[model samples]
Each structure stands twice: as structure tokens, then as C-alpha cells.
Target: VLFMGITFVADGFGIVATDVPTTKTVVAQVASTVFGPDSLGYFSFQGFTALILFLAANTSFNAFPRLAAILAEDGYMPRHFAFRGDRLAFTLGIVLLGAISAGLVALFQGDTTRLIPLYSVGVFVSFTISQAGMVRHWRAERSAGWRRRAAVNALGAVLTGVVSIVVLLGKAPESLLVAIIIPILVGLMLFIHREYGAQARELEVRPEIVVGPPHRRERVVVPVPALTRAVVQAVNFGRSISDDVICVHVTDDAEAGERLRERFERQMPGVPFVIVESPFRSLVRPFVAYLDVTGTKDPEAITLVVLPEYVPRHWWDRILYNQVTNQLKRALLGRPNTVVSTVPYRRES
Candidate 1:
């Protein structure tokens, strides 16, 4: 009704729609004409319209994130979308929507004429789907007034569906983008749902399965780079847990490996040392390969890879030492029945 009134007023004023630069300022133009173009009423009306538009723009920010969160909870979207931030808001969804909206605006160069067709198609399609769902609900419930409610919803669905199709056909060149994007989004959601289902099935437990102690035995493997106090501390901790502790070292030079092995044997007597030769001087690969070999030997035993890390006196001093422990931890992650433990040795200030 408001739009119709504006159109009538603009026609009466002899203001040609083509002469108007953009559809967005039509209401302001109408007000300007009514108030002699310079009156306070003209400027005030424009201010009010601007305020309303700003408030209207907030609807997507509120709706999209909540819808995304619900979809995420149902396993049709990424799980991160369902997580609430410190402010109890769906921060990721809000940020994502903002980014996509900004990208679309920039892509179209903020031209309302070009963007409106896409908006209209999306809005009417959603309206049609919602009304159709309501009609289905009314029929399923079949209450005393269901026939009337269903009839009204059915009419709405037909009207909106017609509008959606008409807009798509009329503005195919512009609205085609939305048509293409919708199917891509649907495909992505289906992929997420399938992945979630596969993961759930893999982790599913059966009633026939009897639960017992996790592992039959525990074997600790400490990777030693040098005969430092940190290495000795980790080896001691490994031995305290189980007598089956093996210290490993990856060295390209055999002489250096022998010197470390001698020092390790002398410091921690009776503990076995395994030196892995890495011709390429690669650390993580050779270390992980040695672990895989040991794991293959005793599949039932848990291979606990304990790494020794020296704590820098100052936070900024950490860059001086190589982050071998962090690298090894990342490389060994997700290996079956393999646990990575870190033993931090605090250094003196």
C-alpha cells in the first residue's frame, strides 16, 4: 500500500521514473516535491527513511546466523556455525554473512537496479517455500479450522511461487546468479550431511560389544636429540610409568649418534637406545616411520611418544631453540593407539 501510494504521488507530481537516478531515493524525491524541495519536512522524511532502511538491513544479520546455527546442529552445516562466542552470539555465522554480503555489494558496484532482481527472486522463493510448508502442516494437523488455514496458505504459496517464477524469467540475466548459487549451496549442505553420517556410523557402538580396559600394555618411546637435562627428565618419567621404555634418536651422522647413545647409556643405564638413520636429514618422517614399525610389532600395546621440551626463561627467548617437539607432535597426531606426551623442562632465569 505504501509503495502504491508513493507511485501514485510520483505520477501526480509528473516525476518520471526514468528521470529518477535510483529507485532507493524515490521516497525522498516524493517528499522533496511535496515540501517545496527545501522544507525541513523533506529532509526529515529522508532521515526517517534512512533510519528504517538501516533497521531493515539488520534482519538478515539476525536470521541467517540463527538459521545457520540450526542447520549446523542438524549436521547439514559445519559444526563451528553452532558454537556461540563469548557474547553468546553466533560470531562465525555473523562474520560469514557480513563478508558474503559485502562481497555481493562490491561485485554489483552497489547498483540497486541490478541487485533488486536477485533479491526479489530469493525473497519470493523463500516465501513460497514457507507458505507451502504451512499448507502441509495444516493438512497434517487437520484441526477444525484447518481447511480455511490451508486454503489461505495454499493461495499464498501459489501467488508467491508465480511471482518467483515470473521474476526469474523476466530478469534471467541478473537473477540467474541466485539460481546457480542456490543449487551449489544445497549440494554443499548435502555433502556435509553425508560426511556427518559417515563419521557417526564409524564411531557408533553396538549393544553386543563388551567394554574392558583400554589397552593390554603401555610402551613409552622418548625421542632424544641430545643428552640434555630435559631428555633425562623425559626418560625418567617414561621409565616411571613402564619399564619398557626405548629412547630414539634420528641422526644423519653415525659418530654423533654413537656419542649420544654412549652418553644416554651411561646416564640412564639398562635403558635401550634405538638410533634411526635419516640420510636426507629429515626428522619427523624418520621418527614417525620408526614409530610405525614399533606399533606394527606390538599392535596391542600403546606407543606413548614422549618428547622433551626446554622452557625458555623469557617468552621471547623461545625463538632461539628449534621447535622439534611441536613439529613431532603435529606429525604424529591421529595415529591409531599412539599418544604424544610432552615433558617441559623449566630453565633458570
Candidate 2:
């Protein structure tokens, strides 16, 4: 309010000093005329105004992180946002706000006149929602003089909502962004709320259940792609776990399967073969089918599927190969009493 009063006075003097009346009142231009351009007074006015603007910018810097923390606590945002940084600050929120502000400043090319209208629309919309919520709260409480409180909030909401619409329409493109973004944000919040509610329902503990560690049940299934050193090592790992180490292979050709079995004879002598012929050439589907067979074969057993993953040196090499380990893991996750394990064999450059 003080700033507004000062600006109002300065602007009145600014028009007469400049003589040519312009609707777009530049703050620096007004300050220059009011306090004599390039003088101590002009610079003082600028310095003070800059300080106030800096403080105003800090409002977001301070507020957003705390808001983010609250949202995060309520599961509206990522849990990481609830954590404080080294200096006990909401660093993620601060950094994000800074980035957003920088983008907006760059977008408007630091045009305060253009920026204000867009800023005002979002602010007014927020005010409207907040006031409306208060009115709802007051009505629900039904305390002494609740009617007055509700009336106050209802009036504020109506005024702000109307102002927001007017400002939005008056500034076409700028307020158009607000109209689009506000709805998107509301939708996102609603989605988060639904997800939280669903998770809560899913996680609710039943009244009766025996929670205790019992006798162990495990069945390790090692996938044999080839007679490579990596495959040999993975099979060796499986052998160490139990005497019933089964080697499963999904082959496109029966001839290739026979050849691999011959190679396995020399490489892995003891491990039994469970060869699956896949005519479709779909790795994930065949692997998932094998898991289903294992699941039904011994429904009470823990089917541990161990995969041998080759870690190549180059990024391009990694990209060239199918990410079968991750794909297989994702596919096997839904299977009951089953676990997918991966052993990475780093190849020499």
C-alpha cells in the first residue's frame, strides 16, 4: 500500500515533467523525473525500489518451499520435496521457483507492464479459491457469529473471482496462459489426491492376519542365454544356492537349442536344461510364459529367476542391446512368490 501510494504520487509528477502523456508508465522514467535524472535522489529512488522488488521476489523464494513441503507431506508432490537441504531450506522448491521466475522474466523480456497482468490473474484466482474455502469452513463450523464470517469470505470470493475474470479478459494472451495453466494445475492436484486415496485404500491393514517369518521356500531359476563365461558364472551362482538349479532357455530355432545344449555339456555339466521353443520371437512374452509354467509347476515354491546381464563399456553398446534384465524384472513382478535377480558381468573395452 505504501509502495502504491509512493508510485501514485511519483507518476502524477512524472506526466507533467515528461509532457508527452503515455499510458505505459516506466518506473525508472517516473523516478528520474520526480527526483532529477542521474542525481543522488534518482539513484536513491532506484536503489530503494530495487531493494523492495528484490524483497518481493524473495516472497516466492521463501513461501514456495514451505508450500511445497506441506503439499509433499499430504502426498500431492514427490516425497523428496519434504526433505530440507544442508542449510535446512526447502532447496528443491527454491531452485524450482527460481528457474520458473527466470523463464517468465525471459519470456516477457523483463517487461513489468506485461508481467503484472498475468501475475495479477493467477494471484486473484488463488485469492478467490482461498476465500471460498474459508467461507465453506465457516459455514461447516456453525460457531457463534459464523454467519458474519461466512458472509465476509463470500463477498471476498465473489469480488476476487470477478476481478480475476475481468483481468483475464482485459489481457488476452497473457491471461490466456493463466486460464490454461490454472486448470492444468487443478487437474494435476486432483490426480494426486485420487492416487493418494487409492494408495491408502490399498494399504489399509486387515483386522486379522498372522505376521511371522516361517520355514523358508526358494526355487532359483537361472536363465541360460549361451555358454559364455557370464552364463557359466550365473549358473555357478545358482548351483551354490541349491542342488536343484534349473537352466531355462527360450530359443527361436530347435537347431540352435541343440547346439547350445551341446555347448552347455562342456561349460555347465550338472545344470539341467528346460528349453522353451518360441516361434513368435518375443523375449518378454516367452519369459513371462516360462514364469507362469514355473508358478503352476510348484505353486508353493519361491521361483527366483536369475538373469546374466552384460555391461558393455560404451553408451552406444548399452543402447544397442535390449534392456532384457529390466523388461524381465518388470514382467515377473506380478507373478506371486517369484523374484527376478540380475548379475552384471562387465565386459572389457
Candidate 3:
């Protein structure tokens, strides 16, 4: 009430809505007008205003993490979001929200005029959702005076929903982004939930479990483009892991393939070398096809694909080399019982 009165008085003094440089500085203008600019009263009010703004900014930090944790629990978000930090805070949520907020601010160049519409639309939409949810809860419960409670919630939902529409229309192309983004986000959440359900079904443990003989056989398939030091390192690692280690090379040129085969036989004797001929000169697809054939041939044994990666001495030098290791890893990520490993051999210079 006191703040309302102050606002009214500020308006009467022509400091609220008149000739204001910016809406954000209106409070400071009012404080300066009511009490002399250099007065303690003015400074005190300015301090209070700063604190209020600070609290407003902290509001999302309080609410967003808990909301994210709930979504994660429902499998709509990543499982890591459900984890709490040492201080029992949803640390990832906080960090992610902070980064997003910073990005939004930066994207708009800190233009409140542009940002406020998005914020208003978001707030009213949330209000409508909450009110509608309450109405549904009241209807489900059907306790005494449930109709009255539900009616009140329904009114709130209608009013907020109308406001959301008005804001979106008034805000035009800016708010259009919200409309597009909300549906995309909803679709993404649904997709995540479906994926979680499928994964849960696949990994579910059952009571009809029986102890079987130990399967100690693992085939280590190292994809070596050339017989370099990096290939040697990966081959050595693969040999340590399994005796059934083989080097597979894919090349469009038969001559080059035979040359690499001879080099492999001379350098690493007793190791099996398989040359995959790719007339199309494609690297990842042909390699993946070979793995598929091998996997179908021996479904019982685990296939470990060790990719040898050469690490550049300088970070900027990385862009010079094609990232075949990452490409292969991404391609074989969903392959059943196939493990992808990269042994990075760092260059000295």
C-alpha cells in the first residue's frame, strides 16, 4: 500500500510517466524527486531499489532448478539434471539456466524493450498452465466446494490465457519465436520420454535370470588408416585387451591396401590384417558395413573397435586433420554390443 501511494505521488509529481529517459530508471527518478538528489532518503531508496532488482534476478535461480529436477525425474530431461551438488543444489540446472539467461541477454544486446515481451508471454503462459492444472486437480478430487475452487481456477486460466494471446499478438514477430519454440520444446520432451521408456525396457532386469558360462572372448578390431606410431599404440592397447586383435584398413586403391597389408605383416607379425575395398572412396559407411557383417557373423563375441587418433601439438592445428575417429565413434554409437575406443597419440612438436 505504501509503495502504491509512493507511485501515485511520484506520478502526481510528474516523475513516473512523464519525460522519463528510460522506464528502468523511473524508480531512481522518483527517489531523486521526492527527496533531494544528494539526500540520504534518496540514496536509501536507490539502495532498496537495487536490492529489489537483485531479488528479481535471483527468482529463476530458486525456481528453475527444482522445475528441471522434476522434469528429469519424469524422464523429460537428462538424468544428470536430477543430481544435486555438495550443497544439495541442482548445480547443472543453475549453470545451464545462467548460461541461457546470459545468452538471451547477449542476443538482445540487453534491450529490455525487446526482452520484456518474451518474458511477459512466458509468465502468462506459465500462469495459464498452473491455473488450468489446479482446475484439473480440483475436478479430479471433487471434494466439498470443489466447484467453487475449480471455477476460480478456471477464471484465472481464462484470464491468463487471454492475456497470453494479447501479449503474443501485440509483440508480433518477437513473440512468434515463443510460439514456434514452445512446440519444438514440447516435441523434444516427448521424444526424450519415449527414448527413456525404450531404454528402460531394453535394460530392465528380470527374475528369470540364469547363470551362464563366462564368455571371455572379445574381438578387438583396430581401424588403421596407415601403419603409423598412433596405429601401433592402438594395436598394442587392443592386444593387451584381447588376443583376437585384428587391423582393418579400408581403401579405394587396391595397391595402397596391399602395401599397408605388407607393412602391417612386417611390423606386427602374427596379427591378422583385413583389407576392406571401397570403390566409392567413402570411409565411415564402408567401415560400419564391415563391422555389421562381422557382428552378424559372430553375435556372441563383443566387438571392440579401437580407433587410433593423432593429437596435434597445437590446438589450432586440429582443424587441419579430418576427425575420422569422431565420425566412426558417432556412426557405431548405437551398434549392439560394440565398444568404440580412441587411443590419442599426441605429437611431440
Candidate 4:
């Protein structure tokens, strides 16, 4: 209501500033006298339109992310979009929406007059459907004499449906058919995806309930970075499980590779450190390839890739180091018979 009132006031002020005569008979009216009255009116309309578009864009930016999060929680979208980033709420969704809006703005050349009728029709249709659904839900519950609630909701549905029909009649011939059809297609796709996901969930395997003498043992793969306390802890933990333990390292440079090998030889005499030299200077591919080779060599082995990452007290410290550990973890997760774990090292503040 406050937004509506402010918009109304702004629109009124714009009209008054451009169309209304300030003085009864002033000889000092310079600007309006130079440009024609119609020109001034057009300029004012354009300015007001720009202001409304700016407001609409801001509102969309705020609303789209929240909507995306809600959809993600409901399993309609990827789970990553459900959480807020450090500085922005639904950062990925907002970026994606911005890119989409940019494409749309370019396609339509930012013409609101052409877009308004197409926009309102779907809104009214959705309103009508929602009200109808509410009416049906109230009718279904029967508690506290739901007839009254149903009647009220039915009235809302009727009003919205009438408005929607009027809008369709007024706008369909005027390039709104394409807009309406696009949304219908999108909604259909969403429905199909939801159904498919539901079926997939039903077909998914449940964890076993068998007890005693586990059929398989876990394979622990410790990522050998340096002879640090964290590395020792990881290796010790992996050894404690009485399972196969392997150490992995990727070499992008020969000097760094030889240094890491010597450090492993000196610090971790018992543990075997396998280094895969990366021709492309990429960590993910080499690490994943190593996992594949290990798995092929011992098909029964469960490869657990343990990565040690430094937890910085200050955010700036994080900016200096490239996130190779996180990348390696993600890559290992994509391969079969492989599990990745992270051991965090906290730096002194």
C-alpha cells in the first residue's frame, strides 16, 4: 500500500511539473516556451517511465532470489540456490536472473508499453488459479463450517478470472499470445520435471540394514601437501581404520614435485605418496585420473581422498591462496568408489 501511494504521488508530481502552467501570465517561462508543449509532455512521460522501470527492476532483484530459494527447497531447483552468500541473498539466482533480464531487455529494447499488457495477463491468471485452489482446499477441510470461507475464496476466483479473461481479450491480438504461450510451455516443463524427480526418488535405493562384519572396508587416501601437523593427523586417522591408505599429490612444476616427494620420503616413510605430473597444470584432472588408476588396480578398495585446508582468521588471507584442495575434493567426489574428506587447519590469529 505504501509503495502504491508513493508511486501515485510520483506520477502526479511528474504530470504537474510538465503539463500544469506554473504562472498565470509569466513572461519568464523560458524552457517550455522554447520546446513545444507536446515535446515537454513526452519528455516527462519518458522520465516517469524510466523511474517506474528502475523501481520494477529493483523489486524483481529482491523478489527473484527469494522465489528461487523457495523453489529450490521444494525440489524444483538445484539446492545451491537456497542459501545466501556472504554478501548477497541468493547470489547465484540473482546473477542468473540479471543475465536473463538483460537478454530480455535487449530483445525488447526496454519498452514497457509493449511489455505491460503481456505481463499483467499471466499475473491475473496465476491469481485466479491460486484463489481457485484455496477455495478447493477450504471446501476439502470441512472444519468450522468452511462453506463461508469457500464462498469468499470463490468470489475472489471469479473476480480474478473475469479480469484475466478481459486482459486476454484486450492483449492477445496485440503480441501477448507469444508471452502467454512461453509461460505455458515453461510451466509444463516444470510439471514434467517434478514428476520425473518424484519417480526417481521412489526408485532410489535404501541403505542396507544388515549388521556385523561389514562386507567392505573403507579406503582412505590422504592428500600429501607438506610435513605439517594436519597431514600427520590425517595419516594417523586413515591408519587407525585398519584399511588401505594411499597418499596422492599432483605436480604442475618439476621443482615443486621433487620437493614434495623428498618431504614425503623424509616425513612419511611408511606411507606411499603417488605423484601424477599434470601437463595442463590442472589439479582436478590429474587427481581424478589417479583415483581411476587406483580403483582399477584394486577394484575392491574404497578410495577416501582427505584434503587439508587452512582456515584463515582473516578473509584477506583466503584471497591469496588458490582453492586447489577444494577443487581436488570435488573432482574425487565425481569418480566411482571414491570418498573425499577435508581436514581443516586453523591459522593463528
Candidate 5:
């Protein structure tokens, strides 16, 4: 009746001369017909629309990250995603969702009709899964009120499952794309789970190994970059961890190596230093080669590869500095039972 009155007012007052009587599909159209364009009411209608849409989006921000954190805890997603920000929000998941939403908006070219069907598929799928899980939970406990809960869950599961299927089958191409994407996501999640399991096995402390304190020295190796505050700090960390610290410097120039050797002797006189002559002029390989030599000599002892890293004042400054640390860490980590440690010294601009 309100819509009809709006149309009547629109036609009578000659506000918007359009043949959109039966088809007031657009919200703005109906709004303009009721309250003339550029009026307070007109702006208020659009404002409320924006507010409601944003509230719906905020729901996604809240829900998806918590779900991702749960998946991470269950070993189905990367542990990094489970980390919360200062505000206790899942920062990675929120950023990931923002990127994904942007990509999706671009993909659909801002067409809501095309977008709605895909959203419906996700919503119903989640609903169905949650209901099914709840049913299982209630059945497992079988406590007081479990029967009622199970019945509710079962009903919800059936309803949502049916709706999910209908939405998926009815919407062609878009729904088909979602179906394809879901399996790929599942495959990725499975891969993550497998990796987490493998890592857990590798890092697990067996009862046999820890039964006795076997005779082994902790050999700390500090890969020497330019002996700045960073290197000094890294060496200090190495000293704290272990008494036997060996500083290895790799250089193509024999003359520069001699200079560094002299400097090491003058500054860090007590600690042992080795000059690795790398004719190939590569940092990581020569360092790894030296580590391999150390490992072969004393197979029982654990080698601690301590690399000094400088965290610059800003993020862009990171590219200018931290390249050597990652490559060396990667190479060092491959050697079994060897722990790679980074001593970060933040550099102020």
C-alpha cells in the first residue's frame, strides 16, 4: 500500500515521470518516487542502505577469522593465521578476506545478482555443516536435554542441506565456479594438515632420547656479516647460549678476509674465528659447506646457526637489508638436528 501511494504521488506530483509502476526493482527508484530526488529522505534511505550493508560485512570480519583460527588450531590451516593482533582480532584472516573480497567484486563487476547466489551457497553450506556437527556432538554426549538438541540439529541440518543443494544446482556457472574452488581449498587444507603432522613428528621429544644426558657439546656458529652492532649483539647472544662459539666469515677477496681476521682478533680476541675462502663469491653455500664440515667432525653435538638480522625502522627498509639471513637460514635448516636461530637488532632511522 505504501509502494502504491508512492507511485501515485510520483505520478500525480510529476516527481519522476517513469513507467516503473509494476517494476520498482531499484531501491533508489522507489525512494525517489516517494521522496523527491536530493531530499533529506532520499539521502537518509541511501545512508541506511550503506549502514546495513557495512553491518553485514562486519559480520564476515568477525565470523571468518574465528573460524580460520579454529581450523588452524585443529591443524587444518597455517599456524600464522591463528595469531591475533593487538586488538585480539585475527589480522591475517581479515587482510586475506579483504583481498579476496576485492578480487571477487572485480570478478563479478559489482553485479549483486551474480554475487548473491554464490554467497547463498557459502551461507547454506556453513549452516548445514554446523547443524550436522551439532547433531554429532549431542549424540556423543547423550546428556540431559541431548535428545531435544539432537532433534533440532538434525532438522536444521536437513533444511540447510536441502537449501544448499538447491542454491548450488539452480545457479549455473557462478555456483559451478564455487564448487570447483571449494575442492581446491579442501586440497590445500589437507596439504597443510599433512605438513603440520609431519612437523609435529619431527619436533616431537621421544622418551628414549631424553632419558639420559648424552655427552654432547652445543657448538654455536655465528655467520659473520659486517661486524656492526648487529654482529656484536648476535655474538653476545651466542656466548650466552654456549661457551664454544665459532665466527665464520666468507669472502672472495683474500685481502679483505685478512683485514676482517685482524679486526676480529683485535675486537673479539678470545673467541675463535675462521676465514672461509669462497672463490665462487657466494655467502650461503660456503657457510653451509663450513657447517657441513663442523657437523661431520662431531656428529653427536648440536650445531646452533645464529644469524644476525637488522630490523629497519620501516617495512620498505627491510628489502635493503634482510636478504642474506633468509637464504642462509634455509640452507642451514636442511642439515639434520641443526637449529637455526636469528638474533634481531632493530635499527632506528
Candidate 6:
């Protein structure tokens, strides 16, 4: 109604030129007169495209999370993502969606006109599938009164499927190659992932692993890098749980190790600094070897590896450094009888 009224007003006034070849030309003229001639042509299109993108952004931020939560409840995604955060938002889904959208924006150079055909294809496909699903669901109910509902759903499915077909036929020759490719690829991945997850669950350890009580707390070996505030916090955190705290530091060079050891002795007086030799300059291997050796010596003791990590507030800060903490965590998870905990300190802005 609002759009119709606006069209009526534009037609009544001489503002919109009927002689214009395209809506883009009219938009350019209007925007140029209102804003400036500099803000015409592609700039006008870009501004309008940005506005639509902003509106569509809410679909991923709000609608996608709700849909994901529903899928998660039906065992599609991880249950953790379904939970609401302190800010009453699905933080996990929101973050994931934001990351994906940002990647798309970067990939397409933020030209939403290029992205729209692809977006429309997915929207239509989903609409068609959803309508078909509803038809099936209504049919399965199969009551005397459900005949009307089933007919309505069947009609809806037909209409949506036709629209989807029309969109595919009309847009494919245009800039919709990505639209067709992405959805098919995504659907295949989702199918493969679902099958893998199902197979994994089926082959999982039985009553022995699932029903039994958790193992008792064993010895904890905390490897501290150096006597920094972060390391101090990690050591204190580890000590709180278990008194068996052995700080291991891997050194590629002997001289560097000696210098670090002397500094450690001065800063952390009583804490023993065990130096591990690494000729390959690998940080993960020596600590893993230490954990293996400790586990062999005391099989009953649980090893708690406390790693102090610095979390950067800005995304650019992460690009400056190699993510050693993430690599270390991944390596630690591969080891047996070891639980890794990260104590993160946010870098001061």
C-alpha cells in the first residue's frame, strides 16, 4: 500500500520522468537532486543496496538463530548454540552468522546487487521445500477435518515450487550461478555431516562409557610459559585444584632457556622450572611427552594443563600474532588422561 501510494505520488508529480529507460536512472536523478550530483548512478544503487542489506541483516541476526534453535532442538546443530546468552541473544548463532556474512561481503566486495540473485534463489528454494514439508506433515495427520488443511498445503507447495522453477529459469542465465551452486553444495555437506554424526553415535562406546561414573580427579601438571601475570594467574588457578603443579617451559636454544630459568627463579621463587629441549622448535611435542611420562609414572592421577592465553579485543590484534594458544589447545586434546583449561586475560585497550 505504501509503495503503491509512493508510485501514485511520483506519477502525479513531474519528479519521476516517464521517458527514463530504467528505474536506476530515475533513482539516480532523484538521489542526485536531493543529496548531490556526485551521489548518482552506481553510488545511488550502492546506497539503496546498502539499505536493503541492512534490513536483511536482521534476518540472519534474528530469524536465522530462531530457525537454528528449532533445528538444534531436532538434533541438527549443537545444543549449546540454542541457549540464550546474558544479553538475551543467541550469541553463538549471531557470531557464526556475522562471520559468514562478513566473509560473503568481503568475497563479493560488498556489492549486494551481485549477491541478491544468489540470495533470492536460496529464499525461493527454502520456501518451496517448507511448503512441501507442510503438505507432507498435513497429509500424515490424516483426519476427516484435515482434508481442507492438506488441500491448502498442497496448493501452497505447487505455487511455491512453480515460483522456484520460474526464478531458476529466469535468473540462472543472469548472475545466479552462485545461487544454484552454493545451495546444492551446502545441502550435500549437510547431508554428509548428518550421516557422519549418526554413524558416529551408532558406533559409540556402549553402557561402559555412557552409564558409568566419571573418573576420579588425578594429578594436574600445569605448564607455565614464564613468570608473567598471566602465568601467575594460571599457576594459582591450577594450585587451587591440585598441589601437584609442575611448570614446564620448552626452549629451542639452551642459552635462552638458561636466561629464562634465572628470570623465573627470581620472579617465581619456589616454583621449579623444568626445561624441555626441542631441536625441531616444536612447542607441543615436549609438553605432550611430559604429560605421557607423568601419566606413566602415576596412572591414577589426572593431568590438568592450565594454559594462560591473551585474548585480543580487536580482530586486527589476532592477525599480528601466530595463534600459538589455539594450536597448543588442539595438541593437548589429542593426549590421553589430560584436561586442558585456558585462563584468558583480555589485552588492555
Leading candidate by TM-score = 1
Model 5 residue 342 distance off true place after TM-score fit, in angstroms: 4.8
* Candidate 5 residue 54 C-alpha distance from true site, Å: 3.1
Model 1 quality (TM-score)? 0.86
lDDT of 5 by residue, 57-109 (tens): 99998989999999999999999889999988899999999999999999999
lDDT of 4 by residue, 262-304 (tens): 8888977877777788878777787777777767767876677
Instruction: Write the candidate numbers in order of decreasing lDDT.
Output: 1, 3, 5, 2, 6, 4
Better candidate by TM-score, 2 or 5: 2
Off by over 4 Å in 3: 11-26, 37-40, 83-92, 99-114, 141-152, 162-181, 206-218, 223-243, 248-270, 273-302, 308-338, 343-349
Model 5 RMSD in Å is 5.7
Whole-model Cα lDDT of every candidate shown, in order: 0.89, 0.82, 0.89, 0.72, 0.86, 0.73
Ranking according to TM-score, highest score first: 1, 2, 5, 3, 4, 6
lDDT of 2: 0.82
Clashes of 6: 4
Instruction: For residues 1-349, write the lDDT of model 1, one tens digit per residue.
Output: 9779989998898765543444536687789888867899988998888888888889889989999999999999999999999999999999999999899999989877788899999999999999999999999999999999999999999999999999999987989998999999999999999999999999999999998876568999999888888888899999998889999999999999998888888878999999999999999999999988878877988889888877677667578764888889889889888889988878665
lDDT of 3 by residue, 1-349 (tens): 9679877877788864433336536677778877888999999999987898799889989999999999999999998999999999999999999999999899889877678789899999999999999999999999999999999999999999999999999998778778998899999999999999999999987879876876746999998899888889999999998899989999999999999899899989999999999999899999988988988877888999998776677777677664888789889998888898888877675
Candidate 2 lDDT over 18-113, as tens digits, reads 323453246677766767778999889778888988998889889999999999898888768889999999999998888998999999898776
TM-score between model 6 and native? 0.55
Of 4 and 5, the candidate ahead on lDDT is 5
The number of the candidate with the highest lDDT is 1
TM-score of each: 0.86, 0.74, 0.68, 0.56, 0.73, 0.55
Q: Model 5: how far is 93 from its true place, Å?
A: 2.5
